[model samples]
Target chain A: MAERAQRKIPDSSRRSERSRRAIHEAALALIGEVGYAKTTIEGIAARAGVGKQTIYRWWPSKAAVLLEAFLDLTGEAAGAGEVGGEGESESEAYAIPDTGDLEADLKLVLRATVDQMNDPRFDVPSRALAAEGIVNLELGTEFVRKLLEPQLQLYVRRLTAAQATEAGGVRRGVDPRIALELLVGPVTHRWMLRTAPLTHEYTDAVVEYALYGLAPRP
Target chain B: MAERAQRKIPDSSRRSERSRRAIHEAALALIGEVGYAKTTIEGIAARAGVGKQTIYRWWPSKAAVLLEAFLDLTGEAAGAGEVGGEGESESEAYAIPDTGDLEADLKLVLRATVDQMNDPRFDVPSRALAAEGIVNLELGTEFVRKLLEPQLQLYVRRLTAAQATEAGGVRRGVDPRIALELLVGPVTHRWMLRTAPLTHEYTDAVVEYALYGLAPRP
Candidate 1:
């Protein structure tokens, strides 16, 4: 989380924004270099060239700092429209670009997601956080509620729209929430598990298979 | 894994089998209680009431011990046909009941998988190991190859069979390996990420959606 954004400080405080960005970058770099367990607030402060008290005043705990840093990184990514992470602007961040072609729109978004997950800056720290979340239930639930679920909701909105559209809309009785998973889940499994290479071809295959059933198409 | 199993020692040696089972139980119990990082070989030995050398002799590292222990637990579950884990008897363990219906067979197997994941004995330790694997790339890769991939292969073989069969076969051009992810990945995402309540209702929906495209029926 950008401190200024969260605190509702005026944009005039460029120095504070610089500090927040440095801290975010430091937290991410440190976590990526050393696993989540080893990351420390003091260490982050040192790395960011800020006093320890500065960090303490801003964030409550190391987890909070890391969580916010992650959110900020994703928010920046969303701001640039580089990948999957949505920004504070819900409408723009979550919009799925319904090009009147559901398949094409989904492919576009998912392909970008594949790129985002593969990006080193995002992948390394995200994996560390994700690893921690798996064992740490409280942290995991918070991560899901705050980060992952909101992103998934974007898909829900897009799918819901597709349901209403006449041009290749979803079939009756299909749940948008669950249908979105068929597309998202496979990519996530491959990326997280490292079971296979996550490539455009793979994402394309996933989108195709998800839109059309695996059994022979009648 | 199990040195005794590999050595083909006579089944008459009940003492050795007992010791191995004890160690496996201890490792799983310790990891589930304390998390993976705190779990040690000495701890496992003390808990099992066996000498430390016994564990070291059988497995090279804590990871190996936990891996094999998990394997044993799941194998036992598979032997009972309680869940998805395949037993030593590949044919029986891997077999998806070929009742001439592919969809039913997939659903039956996936539902069993949900049950296995939900089982406390499996869920707790498995989560710890999975958590460690996420950050530790080497460990994660090993876990996937030793534990996850083999189980996935069972799906691959079953799907291949479905492909060949004239009745309820998968459509041409669907890669069994990738197609299997559609079924397995969503459930894993839910189970691992704790996105929502994993239930038969959810698994059933997944199966229905995966087998039938989301697109409207003509």
Candidate 2:
């Protein structure tokens, strides 16, 4: 088996890249199937058809492996949003678009989030990880810090830009961090709890309710 | 064991009540320790020191048992809010207070919710069930319909009244159902994710941002 693997990839750089991708795929699939608690380095390496040392060489821990795997998954979605040629930076593509209409921009982004959350490939694995996170405080904090918070930070950036925009900006005093949570928190609550249909209409209502005061407009 | 239980309660009614309470407590404890999937009818009965038939006689399934158990736990918190001299209805106790000042009323209730969520007895068992619910759609849906939605409906009732009230009410077009999610959702998200400290100050800020438009007040 080792000889076959080595023969199939004569170039070490290409061989390493192949092993990394396989490990990520194996990690995601295993975590989704058996759950985070049961998924292990040996299992992942066996599934990926690589030595356990290969996984260890790339990641210090299982959590780190899963973290990078999720990042890679989200990165694919981000990369797809790029209109620029292949050479464009990854970060710019993942940004919440500044369409100059803050409300519209937010609604658009949230709608896409609804779509992503609904997709089984994303939703199933995410639910598994999120479920584990809920019970395991250390894992939960790491999931938030590594995966969820970075995505949230995008909203923070967009909202902050809206604050400085010439027109249709948020009020000066509103904390972008907390304000961003208003958009994210509600959608997440519904999604996680399975309380309501996560439709575009629902997300739009959230955006509208959030932007305009719930109280009567004076 | 049965004879001793009967001797402890000469009245069958009192005996049944004791058994029911034990079953509920056992279900909660088991679910907290072993989680929803691993928790079973036979296990609950063994832990509660009751016959399997006794649990099934009271609850149709393990899910039903756990649901009632959680309701019982939260019901204690709800019951404590009552001030009447013993004749008050249970539903009345759970209602969000309508003090004519919408902001104050919301903040008060949300603060109470924060307190409930932080309690280890409530928090630990709740997190376990919630974690299970995240991955288990059937349980998640059942949990929402039976427990969460009813609690949320209190917000709906309050918001609907606010719309009709002469002072400090919501706007005419705001859908109370959707509007209530903004309040419940963010707090739930913070509690479940442990993204930040779920404090009175945070909830108050949520209430303020939610009531006032995130956009600059025109």
Q: Write the per-residue lDDT of candidate 2 for residues A155-204, one digit (tens) a residue.
A: 88988999886585698888888888789988999899988889999999
lDDT of 1 by residue, B1-218 (tens): 78756977566568888999999999999998988889999999999999999888888999999888988887776666533454445433545567778888888888888899999989999888887787778989999998889888888988888888666568878998998888998999998899998898999899899888798866
* TM-score of each model, in listed order: 0.89, 0.89
Instruction: Tell me the docking grade of candidate 2.
Output: medium
DockQ of each: 0.68, 0.72
lDDT of 2 at B100: 93
Per-prediction backbone clash count: 2, 0
lDDT of 1 by residue, A28-84 (tens): 999888878889999999999999999999999998898788878777666555333
Which digits, one per residue and each the tens of the lDDT, describe model 2 over residues B117-170? 999889988999999888887998998888988888889989999999767569
Query: For the second chain of model 2, what is the TM-score against the true structure's chain B?
Result: 0.89
Which segments of candidate 1 are over 4 A away from where they belong? A1-12, A82-92, B1-12, B82-92
- Return the DockQ of model 1: 0.68
DockQ top scorer: 2
Positional deviation of A150 in candidate 1, in angstroms? 0.7
